[model samples]
Target: MMPKFTHIENDRAKMVDISGKGEVVREATAAGKIFLRPETLKAIREGTVMKGNVLATARVAATLAVKNTASIIPMCHPIPISSISVDFTDCEGYIEAVVVVKMTGRTGVEMEALTGVSVALLTVWDMVKSAEKDAAGQYPVTAITDIRVVEKKKGK
Candidate 1:
């Protein structure tokens, strides 16, 4: 049998009830990469993206995005977030953003983590788009890819 949709009832969308569920320590990590041109990458590395520090700006955006995930995603509960961390890794022609979120609540924080990574990567794109855009005014080399939750853990 197919699984039932958690947010649908009586053919309408609705929020899940988690009031009865016991609060537990929840953690989740997500990651994604954004491909950029070599010149753009060098500019990012040299802290000369013009939009200011790419990683630092993205980190702040990720943190804020994680905290506001519930507000943005319908059906998500407004749970208290205990901690959040954003990290980055540079590859051959791309940059990876990893976001981790922790909470002691009735529900997990997987969505929040994923949202953080996505927003962070998008922030990177915005920061470097000017440098990567071609004469056609398009971002041919700028792309956000492989966004996924890498880890999740509950209460100890």
Candidate 2:
């Protein structure tokens, strides 16, 4: 048996329709972690990263990503996002980016939240790539992982 896909109909790919659903307040929170070398983490902590304030830059990137997620993801519906929040947590040898997206619409904002977290983590990596690179100019110790929607809520 073939698995069903919400974006597929009659052997054609299509965007899912939420038009018949009533408008509701929807929110989603997503999180991802970027692992870095000890030195890279220290540089971010000391505000000495070459690019600039890493978290602030990431936050802006996340906000934009949330708003533009529909463009990047073909099946995602264009949603009216009411609020977006981005936050970062500094931990041992890693940093975590969390994004929360809220909107009153027929569809949920999980894709937007996931996109925000992904872009935020990527921005963090870009900001610190110089410090994270080895003599061979490779990022052997840098990685982004665990991108997921940690929370989703909807209310009438």
Candidate 3:
């Protein structure tokens, strides 16, 4: 029979204990999209977004976000991240950003990867919004449509 659900002895919320789990290397990749106006897209492509580098700033922000993921998410266990890569692609009317996080530790780095992508996108939006805001003074809409782990491998 499958095990039945049981509450923790003293806590009201359920939590997973990783103390007994074997340490293993794990990695996760997450991606997100940012839709923008034609002019905004051109500015980014032409290297003229407020005289700032959108992709470069986003990349740095993503790396920092990955390292601080645990502080932002309550249940995430702080893990030592080995490397992080952020990529940006220009899609005619939109921009796609991808963040891949790698770690050699006991816990998976899925949250870190996701957090990186999210914060990076937000930073991009902030940098361009001043020029991309609509006539009504509302910022261009940004969305994080999908976030998922694309790959995983168990360490030997």
Candidate 4:
């Protein structure tokens, strides 16, 4: 049987209690991809997106998102993040955002890492919307996908 949700009690939402848990070194990594036109990828690589540096802006957004995950997520614990790394890679017709978050706290940083990648990809999409839009001002081939946690570790 599936366990009850950790953030629910008496049909009301609540934060998980981690007061009794010991602090440990925790790390998590997440990745996501955004598909776009080949021309758009070239533009991003050449720094000609008309919106300034897309990768740098996305990195900043991802770092901020990782640090603020607890505030944005309803049931997440406010962990002290020790390190965060955000990077982007250009695939054949897509861009991949990878995020890693490390912390020494009672709980893991999986949510933070995932949030980092999500916001990073969203930032990229925002910066390249004009380039990816079709003649009808609609997005045809542009999309965000394959968002998942790639790694998680906990130890002393």
Candidates' TM-scores? 0.92, 0.91, 0.85, 0.93
Off by over 4 Å in 3: 1-15, 140-144
49: Cα error in model 1, Å: 0.9
Better of 2 and 4 by lDDT: 4
What lDDT score is found at residue 78 in candidate 1?
A: 82
Among all windows of ten consecutive residues in candidate 3, which has the lowest summed lDDT? 140-149
Predicted candidate 1, C-alpha RMSD: 4.4
RMSD of each: 4.4, 4.2, 5.8, 4.5
Instruction: Identify the leading candidate in terms of lDDT.
Output: 4
- Write down the RMSD of candidate 3 (Cα, Å): 5.8
Q: What is the lDDT of candidate 4?
A: 0.94
Between prediction 1 and prediction 3, the one with superior lDDT is 1
Clashing pairs in 4: none
Per-residue CA lDDT of model 1 for 18-131, tens digit only, reads 989998999999999999999998998999889899999999999999999989999888889999999999999999999999999899999999999999999998888889
Indicate the residue-level lDDT of 48 in model 2: 91
- Model 1 compared with the native: what TM-score? 0.92
For each candidate in the order shown, give its overall lDDT on alpha carbons: 0.93, 0.93, 0.84, 0.94
Q: In model 1, where do residues sit more than 4 Å from their true spots?
A: 1-10
Judging by lDDT, tell me the better candidate of 1 and 4.
4
